[model samples]
Target: MKKKIILIAVFVIAVAASVYLYAMYKPHRDITAETADFTVSVKQLQEEYAKNDTMFNKKYMDKTIEVKGVVSTIDDAENGIVIDEKLSVTFNDSTKKEIAVGKSIKIKGRLLTYDDILEEFKMDQASVIK
Candidate 1:
């Protein structure tokens, strides 16, 4: 009877530990080497998301994407650069580039979200196309 009880306690502890680990686990996504779910111009992306946000989110959320646009602003801002004043592509510190305003460029990034008030799309973990 004592052995049975001890076995049950151990089983319970094991299950609880497994549950905790599963809860804490967050797998990272590698954008490189993966085909982009969508390749779009910054202006088109902004317009699509603005017109039908729910559909846009369903298609682009948490996915790697490539965007082509002319840089409208670049500075020390943490919010990334504006694309024709319609979108912002914030770069990760490690992947940041020395890009100038008015330069045509393509960038790869994870589509984070859209801001309605600003009428802008935001990307995170962005890297400039070489």
Candidate 2:
């Protein structure tokens, strides 16, 4: 009985370790290759969130999305751009170029959160589509 219990415990331990290692070593998500769950203009996103914060949060939070708007600010430090003064987008790759203020553009990313204090939406792992 003792030997049987010891064998079972060893098997369990090895299985758990294997599972953990597999999870830890999993490949990172390729956000650029993912299809956007929802595509909307910045104004539309802001209005939906403003109308019902909890509802919009449940709908959008952490989901991949594409947004369209005119660029209002570009922060090289953050490696992102503010769209229409409401949505802040952070690019995963820094080599993107041709961005300019007042230019309309489209970006695909995951909707991270909405900052109530800043009255802006936050997204990351973005890439400019246009």
Candidate 3:
């Protein structure tokens, strides 16, 4: 019947679209080895994000960002490191570094979010840029 055929076609299209979206949003298979989408300095990045939180969030969210700045603190307390007291980057749990406070370093990771109350931008699943 034509009606039955039309229903089957719609179902097929719906399944195909679901498959496409799942593939697109799935986490990278090799996140540690993933390349960064943007490279920027701590001060400049923070200023831009602060000025326009929603726009910056949309642009950078879920994308790898490489941020270069002096280490403000290494937070073993949490999951990552804080740079210049503004940008926080979280690497894989197994990753380690001997970075010291005030040492300049670059980190590459997926951007998580920017916190207005803390006035800090956060990143996750990150690695130190050598």
Candidate 4:
């Protein structure tokens, strides 16, 4: 009788532990899926940069985000690539692999708040979606 009770208790504990772990590792729902990708023209992007640098700064500052645009240039040395659109951004090397000039792509990356030498927002570790 004692052995039976101990076995039951052990089984219960094991089940409880498994449930807790599964709950902790569950995938989170993606919020970006609901919002449509922002699309802007290259000329529009340049205008916005000139008109409201601060607002542009606030929109992209240090956030993990996705943007869709046309590839303009790729700089392997700096690991950077540029997207020509309403919000022109330079993505680092990792992003370059995912994009090429004249190709339209969706880039997900962390937007660096600091201004680059080119006066463009630096996008690091960008993942490009064809």
RMSD of each: 2.7, 1.7, 3.5, 8.1
Instruction: Provide TM-scores for the models.
Output: 0.78, 0.88, 0.72, 0.48
Q: Model 3, range 1-130, lDDT digits (tens) per residue?
A: 9999999999999999999999999976555687778888877777777798778778888887788899888778676778899887776874445677898888788877878789888888777767
* Runs with alpha carbons beyond 4 Å of true place in candidate 2: none
Cα error of candidate 4 at position 129, Å: 2.5
Using lDDT as the yardstick, the better of models 2 and 3 is: 2
Specify the highest-lDDT model's number: 2
Q: Which residue ranges in model 4 land beyond 4 Å of their true spot?
A: 1-51, 85-98, 114-117
- The 10 consecutive residues of candidate 2 with the worst lDDT sum are 91-100
Model 1 bad stretches (over 4 Å): 1-10, 22-27, 77-79, 94-97
Give the candidate number with the greatest TM-score: 2
Candidate order by TM-score, decreasing, is 2, 1, 3, 4
The candidate 4 region of ten consecutive residues with least summed lDDT is 29-38
**Clash count in backbone of candidate 1:** 0
Q: Cα deviation in Å at residue 117, candidate 4?
A: 5.1
Off by over 4 Å in 3: 1-29
What are the per-residue Cα lDDT tens digits for candidate 2 across 1-130? Answer: 9999999999999999999999999998888999999999988998898899899989999899999899999999989999999999999978347799998898899999989899999999999895
